[model samples]
Target chain A: MKIIVCIKQVPDPEHAKMDAKSGTVVREGVELMINPFDLYAVEEGLRLKEKMRGEVVAISMGPPQAEEALREVIGMGVDQCILLTSRDFAGADTWATSYTLAKACQKIGDYDVIICGKQAIDGDTAQVGPGIAAQLGIPQITFVRKIDEISEKNIKAERLVEGGYEVISSPLPILITVVKEINEPRLPTLKGRLNAKKAEIAHWGPEEIAADKDKIGINGSPTKVDEIFTPDLSKDGKIFNIEQLDAAAEEIVKKQKEMGLI
Target chain B: MGIKVIKEKCTGCGICFKVCQYGAITMAEKVHTLENGKEVKRLAVIDLGKCTLCSECVKPCPTSAIELKAEAHKFEGKENYKDVMVFAEQRRDEFEEAAFELVGKGRELADKLGVNLYALILGKDLKGKGEKLISYGADKVIAISDDSLFNFLPEPYTNILIRIIKKYKPSIFLAPSTTQGRALLSRAAGKIYTGLTADCTGLDVDSSGNLLQTRPAFGGSIKARILTPNMRPQMATVRPKVFKPLDRDPNRKGEIIEEKVPADLLKSTTKFEKWIEDTTSAISIEDADIIISGGRGLGCSDNFKILFELAEILGGAVGASRPTVDEGWIPYSHQVGQTGKTVGPKMYIAVGISGAIQHLEGMRSSDFIIAINKDPDAPIFKVADVGIVGDLFEVVPLLKEKLKRAING
Candidate 1:
């Protein structure tokens, strides 16, 4: 069971604030962390590796700093990691990003499974995982909440849908995008951290991966953003202070009642 | 490797630096050897590592110094592509509300482009069902009803959609942003080498007959207008409830043709064993008139019970913010935020929610919003109709008691 998990480093959503005046994000003190959902994917990969006794490899396509994210994952028991960083990979939409990642996977050659988070917090597209699977022409079980069964040949998983969950079974060399409900991520052990620090992270660029020049970056990306602007969040709503909690509560109730809203 | 600052065009105005939200842009002092003396010019340098390529900074530059170099893909047989087609996602022979919404929007776009609106009904037992779309707005509905097409396996669904797309080149394609819809359509678009924008809240056909897809990016903090200018079928998945479904007209007539997909192409490596329908979805937050949503301020999972109690009293459904849902306090089905469901209830009571812009995007459309948080400066208060600066554990109970007494009396 050769497990491959894809992760992303994103600005912490809690600290990713906006400058009201400029209508742009305020990034001075914002910190970067592994995309919250991807942690579950990594955890699932680690669990699968522990059960099946194969290597769990983590892959991330980001700037050089994104190597820090891969190192963190390695500290959490991933056998090795790969950092796909290059100027050619900039401005990638889901298609280009997936294409590049898929090409990287092909370069890795032999792999049993590819796991990814349902979606990244920043983009919120949830398109890349399926896009990669599509480019690879492989089976995909997206929004997977749990892995019911697995073996060298096939796997059964529970996928989240609109109303409920669906139990799906797929053959080997499959891709699974997992949601947060999948599992709780484990912390890095002292020994694991030491190993992570000593591990030499493999670096791959377009040339190294044999990526097609036409499908490597922004130029290859089919969709182009014509315009970008901040959403106007300037709604003027009334505010009321609380003196005694009970009195404030009663007033609000009467207010809703008087307004015929209760 | 495209985004760059043209040194010759740059005046060192430093406007792009201020507009860059990613902190990727900085003013670098470059010594320019003038005719008389050396002059230090502050040129804007963009760090590719931090730049998301959102292209926001490009608009504010007076000199048009920054350029994203990419050729608009050219199609050889572009003239052959015609009409607008919608996926018409259905389960158990019943079309989702999103399908109807897409049909209505598709009808509008089709009219604007002087083309037809075609709906694809791909599923099992969809015998008389495809015609329902005609009443809403579809000009033609292609129904691919077969056993292999029953379950929405990504591979099979993608193959079927690709076949239809290849056969009839629609100028535009739309789908619901449901889990199945996103998974299936992304695969289809990728396989076909076309663009597919996700969770678009706005859709319109531009003057050049190009579909202008508008969607939120950066966790709903920013809006992006995307274009698949050179592609045959410009694809996008629309956020549910963003558009209203057109009224059904029995008098309206349209064509409904059943198409067959070869069994080999419909073969799915992924098999669906069972579907445990969310029985609780009957009271889903999307349809609720009053939604009392909790957040991290609720403290822990035990705190959700209060929200449920309040919801039960009001006969409404309980909702949770992204954090609470991500915290596993409640199910993802109850999450009401950007990454979750977009909801517009009559009355939304935010208990302990500090309203991130992402959460606000989903519920800001509510007719009346009441936010209760200890922090008066909480962003939720900014958009809330009634802002209560208090603790939820203390405030929620008293408010519930008063409301319960008033309703009973």
Candidate 2:
């Protein structure tokens, strides 16, 4: 059975900042890293490779520099890397982005399975994976916390719910988006690191994928950001500080009365 | 540099070939001779250049043959301060507190931008609520009232919202971080192809009008402030209880424009299984005027006897951290953190708990925090308004007794 994993490079949210005046993020000088959740997806893929005795491939999309993220995956023992980068692919929303990715998947031809992180931290939409599955016309299971079983044509997984869990199964050519609780990603080894350094990363564009130019980037995207501003929270600005814990119980009741919220 | 293949490590599983979109890789048969002089045939490939380095195929290889390479590069773009808009949720004949809290927040941000505060409300029979929104300081209330919207589903809501957003194009859109809000907003953000910060604790406007959305990230260890440069309608979901609502003015008025929801867009894939009414009348931990929360050091369930008594005396609700819930001392619903609910009570009394980042992320917005733990070094004290280093068992019962005597006298 053949399997594939999709990954993304995102701004290191730790040092990320926004320009209050422009309503845009300051991407320059902000460190970039593989999304945290994608690490789980990579780990799950590697584990599947070990269990099934198959080869693993890493795929990503971004600017030319994002090749570094793919190399990191290569260092973790993935066999190959494919990068989708083009100037025409700018400003794509999840829908257009998913379309580009789905086109890429179709170009790749045959596959038995696909894995992705439940959501990207930078976006936090948790839609791309499912969108890819929808575009592929394949079955999908999301927020998968555990893999119950995997046969040649079927896979069973434990999906996290509000309480307890639900068991779900899907046929082959399926897509699965995973959560952080799924697994701890493995660190790259000395041998894997050396392999990654010597590896050759590949790049693709809309022309190569035969992707519709109209549906590839910002032009293909249906939604647009019209305006951006900070949220306001200037209520009456009331404050009641309780210096003593023993007196807090009474102070709180009185404060609630004054506010009339209860 | 992009992801590369260690052909030597390739298992000929065809996983990478299946993931490659540029068709840059094609499998060919090659014979390998083993030590025993046995010949093995495997799939071999291919040249580069055509590759896009998208990393779509890295995770599926079973033999660990895929990897990603990082390189330093710049994302070219210009900067923006978008407008501020909040989704004013009206359901079950009333407005959700989260919506009001977000409106209060949106109003302040709009003032900072010198822009109009747009409140988007959709529901059945919400015209009366629209006036209250104006009193709360919304510059305008865009109301879409229809029975079809009575049941909050994704398709129609997202479609109509997408239309409104396309027309007005506010800079920032705020939604409450409730299950329903999250369900619709998360998808809506993605459908529109923009950035969304989930469960934000704080929202601020810089001089330029850019939305500063701060939320806990990375299992709650770090606070991440997100900004969507070059993207309009930078979106965020603020947890309930994180902000206060404005005082009501009955005479307040604003422009209330009525919109329509199309019936064709009303269908959804997700079913409404059931609505389990909130069983506990105990004030929502987030709305509680006072909260008596327990930590791991509360010792055991029996030890909470004093906590309950104190909570009852204070006429407030009881809360617990993830640790207490894990220890089986309380139900999981009471757990608060990155996994549980975010709360901001007027006064929060934490007994015998060392606050982890995850736990702190959920309750740091409380008006006043009081921590009582034997360890003075506990992280909870970092944000506590009052810190007492001692045994909670000894201190809580005594504190409760003192409070009761003072009240009775």
lDDT of model number 2: 0.68
- The digit string of per-residue lDDT tens for model 2 on A106-191 reads 88768777888877755555667766765675666666778878887778786643333456566677778887667769899999
Q: Please provide, for model 1 over A1-262, each residue's C-alpha lDDT reduced to its tens digit, 9 standing for 90 to 100.
A: 8888999988765665655454445555446889878999999999999899899889998878888899999899999899999887877888889998999888876788999999987777889999999988889999998999999999999987766789999889999999867788999999989988999999888999899878867778889889887767555666766555555556556656764566
For all candidates, what are the clash counts? Answer: 0, 89
lDDT of each: 0.83, 0.68
Largest DockQ belongs to which candidate?
1
| CAPRI rating of model 1 | medium
**C-alpha TM-scores of all predictions:** 0.90, 0.59
What is the per-residue lDDT of model 1 for residues B1-409, given as tens digits with 9 covering 90 to 100? 4688877777889878866655688888867654555464777788987776768888778989999777666667877898899989886566778889999999999989899899998887886676788999998999887776677778878888999999989989899888888998888888888888998989988888888899877656678899987777789998876787899987789999878778888788999899887775356775566889999999999888898888888877888998888677888878887566667666789999988877876777676788999998887887777788888887888778877887787
What TM-score is obtained by chain A of candidate 1? 0.89
Per-residue lDDT for B235 in model 2?
78
Give the candidate number with the greatest TM-score: 1
lDDT of model 1 at position B139: 89
